[model samples]
Target: MNTLGVTLVLGLLLGVWAQTNIERPQCDSPEAEEAALVAQDYLNAEHTQGYKFALNRIEDIKIYTKPDGDKTYKLEVELLETDCHVLDPTPLVNCTVRPKMMTAVEGDCDVVLKRVGGVLTVTAFKCKTEESTEDICLGCSTLLPLNDTTALDFVHKSLASFNNFNENVTYAVFEVGRMSSQVVSGGLVYLAEYVVVEANCTEDPCVPLNDAMAARGICTAKGSSIAHSVNCQMFLTMMPVIDANVVDVNSTVAVTNSTSAVAPALPPMVHVHTGSLSPKLGLRYHKLTTLHNPELSGLLSAESTESDEVVPVAPGVANSTAPADAGSDSSNSAEVPVVVKKRDVPIVPVVPAPAVVDPIAVVPVCPGRKRFF
Candidate 1:
């Protein structure tokens, strides 16, 4: 064989040996933990809706060191749903995992992180959640995740059709609890069970439901493109003129077609007493913790009300109300007294400017990362 041919073969064998000998990092290592935490934070920040998630466990970790001193880490992380919603702004440390009785949701994510110059950043991540199997029928209907786009579309269309059929009250979709799909001869049939809150107006462009209102109902819809049907039972809260306890007025609306019906009497204004609201409403009113930067907290608290007024003082002198030349011995050695004038200005608290954060840098997906969804 020629010398060139032997050299090429030797180089190929060395490359294969190096590739096979790559080391896998421990899942509990510091680098792996840091990458997982970064990926979790990115997911929480990017997920604008639904409940927030907390890291349950790290499944796998792989680290690849580059020739330029950079390292890429791929992590498979499992996350559990927390009681706090995404809009609560509560720190993950304070959030508790939802119990299984409450239909807890869990997800697995494939995250890729790259460290350059000792700084780690998440490049790409994708998560898939397990669908609920409670009451799922075999070969009849398939349950889908609550975040599925197609199920959500079906929910919106069903709600719109419901509002059009019922002329008594305009209901808006508050939350979609469960959904399932079935294959029929005509087309696909979608079934959605959702909660609806009473909207302020009674038309297509009605105002959104008020947070303080306790009037809500449950609805179940089943249909396809050919036809749809919705049945809703709403409980309206009513405050009696003499009774102390609130009363619930029940109303039912059933529609099998999209045809409009006669308008019924509007329900009275709902007056819910304190501590009697629904659990879902209580979740919406959770007290959010204020998150402040530790480095800027002192500056923010030390802000002076007289920021616009500047009082220049001498380098080694204390503030005083005495005359500028009161303690003068010689004409050249006069003591200057800094007078602080008191004004009757109202002290207004100043709001601190929002801190600017650098955007996360993203790079191409690493070859070591594989999605397991």
Candidate 2:
């Protein structure tokens, strides 16, 4: 090995670890005023138990970024609780009451609101008087469950593209980041960070040396459902604004379990001429077809007849093959020559619903009523 070459390769591998964690330095307050405006919007428009709360004062504000480089803010604030009631004597009109204000002075209870990009929303909140830590502090509360969601299914089940993809694919490594939601079309679209570390190819039963060298895959998902996913690269370019689930953002990649597999692992970000490659996820970006090439055949055939290594497949769907050009969105009119076959996998479970945010607009108490005074 070239001494200079070896030294340079070592530098490349360590560069990725340089990415920032949300804990390093915390902001004393919100960075942009827009965050507060967004916060206020959350409260004035927030309706609970037939009561709408008005923003009183902001208790505290902190800002941080997610692993995917998107910024979000945490705001602790007070709200004035108000409820509407039918006046006993008046049939056509209703009167609003501030019960929390009637007899006793209402001490502010802390409610945290998150503002990311232009979509402002709320998550489950509890006030904490204790000085906050990176993982437990109220500042990090919005980012709770710092662990990856376990055994979740990939949003997209089928792979269609110019890249001849292998059915029953397995990943050497898989990971997802914190969950975040955005407003799109008429509903909230939730997303998470996604990455695939090592993978197999369509042409060769095992990943090839060069393709695995370039075996980049970061796919994510969209839709109100957990059962759908799209490739990140393809999703970014083709999917509409509402988000067909970010393609690579939350990709559904299956992991490889067989040890007799011949596929070479994709090299780590930092190159080491070591005997084996240490696979890392969420680094490179390989196209759907890059993992695929139409030229190779008999890729799925395993050399060892004694052992069984399972490939990942969408639940309840038949295993099948398609052309690289047939990628994700061929017109329904196009003729797909392959027969879809069923391979029984575990059924997909229902994903928890996306958290609710304050309404974008407030509805009126009466047909024409806008204010109390």
Candidate 3:
């Protein structure tokens, strides 16, 4: 081939065309996607109790994407209250700022996609024309989002706190995901993205909700962090779902209240034991044992014979009974001498032994290795 032909072949190889290859789509700028998110968040903010007000024109949108993938956008939007009952806000069709007229009004809006609690949350900064000072929109709060940055020193102080089971937990940058100047709550509540850096997993199936939340692959502690708070086995017979803090009346209350008129009060109530007494129709349970049994009253009082008393005879003491003197007076004929060793006397009250309910009548004999002895 000629030099010109060689050049042509090289050109075709370098120039990948539409027919020879798949069409390459232009990579979307981070700013453009963030603008859409901002507009959607604006609609959500306009949502009221019964109906959600929507906006079509999100005007003059300016999107800013940070290094951490957080996004912020500012625009002007025109509110349009619709009949739709959708709880979530759909994206605006267009963001065109038209000249102000009687029916149409414009408001400045700040929309942001913030990382919060390991989730991305959309937030908007907007102020009503009535609330704003002149043309400048100060959003909802005068404090501004800069208040969150003020807490940075407090956040650094949290490093001293020992967190996690192994004490290997760390403090990370709690970036503000969403900040609202005005909301249902009067003051500003910064919904922040907590950078909880979980410990690195050295092995598979690592412990859940420990330093390795990544092991569980979830932030919630339903099954991961918390085990059963109450006895699972006791309630497992009837209770199906295990929701935290929710009371299941069927499993807990209906256990002892089959035909009872009202649900019995839960006990044993704290600090309520008054040691009260009852008699007659009022039933009471005495801790009945062999020692306290009413049926075995007769056997407890059986006179203690000399052998029944377990007195240890001391080597120092000598007990002797003298035979009647043959020639002495009748009253002085017999004399008994008792020698008692005196030490620190331990006063002991005599208690009779309660009779056994049933004596072992027969013993089972295990003659060989085949028997369970």
Local distance difference test, per candidate? 0.49, 0.29, 0.25
Poorly placed runs, candidate 3 (over 4 Å): 1-34, 66-70, 85-108, 115-120, 129-373
lDDT of 1 by residue, 1-373 (tens): 6999878865654343233212245566666678888978878887654557778777665554534455656566777777555645457888887555434566666665667778888764545554333543444665555556676666665566555545556766666555668887867878766666667663435554767554566567777523566666553421211111101112333434324445354432222212322243313211111122222111111111112332333422211111122211211112111100111122543522223221111221222322221
Best candidate, lDDT: 1
Candidate 1 lDDT for residue 340: 9
Looking at model 3, report the run of 10 residues with the lowest lDDT sum.
Answer: 216-225
For 9-73, candidate 3 gives per-residue lDDT tens digits of 54543332111111111113334344444554544444322123344443333222333444333
lDDT of 1: 0.49
- Indicate whether candidate 1 or candidate 2 has the larger lDDT: 1
The all-Cα superposition gives candidate 3 an RMSD in Å to the true structure of 46.2
